[model samples]
Target: MANSTTAQALQNITGTIALVGAGKMGGALLTGWLDGGLDAKRVVVIEPAPSAEISALAAEGVALNPRQAATVDTLVIAVKPQSFRDTGAVVKPLVGASALVVSIMAGTTIASVREVFGGAVVRAMPNTPAAIGRGITVAVADDNVSAAQRATADALLRATGSVEWVDDEGLMDAVTAVSGSGPAYIFLLAEELARAGVAAGLPEALSAKLARETVAGAGELLHRSELPASTLRQNVTSPGGTTAAALAVLMGENGLQQIMTRAIAAATARSKELAK
Candidate 1:
């Protein structure tokens, strides 16, 4: 469920909202809006292959691919980056002249969005965790976006998780590398940790279970704790203890930090390339 501010913001939108895709991330956003008290009757979902879950939404009053496209107040583009052009051509007519366009498709630029749809655009990067409403999104809007439009975008994005805004769109590539792709890094960590546990003579199943639970529990702890991550690390590490020994290797000169820096730089570079 969305926070109070997000819920109120969703309830406040009186005009029609059209979601252009119903994949995992798009479906997540639709669920968030409804769960946050937005009226289902006001939404329109445009998807060529709607899942059973998405098809079910029509029963609740959401318009599912109406025979004709009508101008809408907000148009959310959540299609795959590679298919955006074709999808944009189909959905462009649904965007009113004064519509607010919010896109969650990574590597798609605000300039490209405006070129296709010609509305006040907000380009956002939201991670996979959004499916569970625990993601974090970073957004940047084009100059034409009004204060109200920006707020509405905020509320919509916040339905799935926390939101941060940036003045410079250039920062979006790095943001995409960090939080947008960060979950995969954590998942990889758990995967490698499980392998290490297996190498240490633990049963494969037990090692996998331990690694999964440890990563999940630690993430939850970080979520609930007010302390900085560094402080939390210190709290767990005692002098020459097991955790400290592991940290010594992970914190070494050619270790996780260096690897992660290079990884993010590569991802950022790829994002920039994709934007072009």
Candidate 2:
């Protein structure tokens, strides 16, 4: 992972950025790209629905729907999986042989994108927190992509938070389950933990606050620390303490590990099903 300074220093390279959708993930990327020194004039967003974000882009002089599709340096596909058939038709012209196509749609294969775009395709999956610059994106690209194109794609994606590259395309389903859909799982955990705390007699507001802050702070600590998660857990657990007691229940057989493994398996299978 690039440190904050390295990530910030990797900005300023410029090129035409055409986002074929203006949904949440696409809008977050557009925000990050602009923040990372990409000129609004060089950016084109094509969203027929034109949400408030698309309207804002229009006000900033970004082309909404152009008369003709022109070749772009980079094309970002952020439409939904169900929408790709239509999106493929709409975005084909902008994707010249040389353009690098980066897609953030989950379960959509790079081969599928190449079939439509006819270019160097990079499959990416970015989380929602990218809107606030705390997302992580995992990308994998075709071998035809040049080093510069890879770097450009990395920089564009890193603007959201951190970027990782995976070699095996099959692993993307697991990545999607772990990160793309992972945030919702964490959110659910926070909600359930808060409710459990409330049921255990803590004040409603206090339980909610504690649960949220605990998860957030733990996440931050994990991010900042170099130690492994197992070490961190060991460091926090004391013999016969509350944390230890909790772990006895949570870390027991058929506990968190088993539950989580099952959950991830289910999600991965669903991702494969969706791809089909």
Per-residue accuracy of model 2 over 232-267 as CA lDDT, tens digit each: 999999999999999999999999999999999999
Which ranges of candidate 2 are over 4 A from the true structure?
1-14
What C-alpha lDDT values do all the predictions have? 0.93, 0.84
Model 2 scores a C-alpha lDDT of 0.84
Give the TM-score (vs. native) of candidate 1. Answer: 0.98
CA RMSD, predictions in order: 0.9, 2.2
Which lDDT tens digits does candidate 1 get at residues 1-276?
A: 998988999999878899999999999999999999999999999999999999999999999974444788999999998898888778887888789999998998999989888889999999999999999999999999999999999999999999999999999999999999999999999999999999999999999999999999999999999999999999999999999999999999999999999999999999999993
| Pairs that collide, model 2 | none
Could you tell me every candidate's TM-score relative to the true structure?
0.98, 0.93
Q: Look at candidate 2 and tell me the lDDT of residue 37.
A: 57
RMSD score of candidate 2 (Å): 2.2
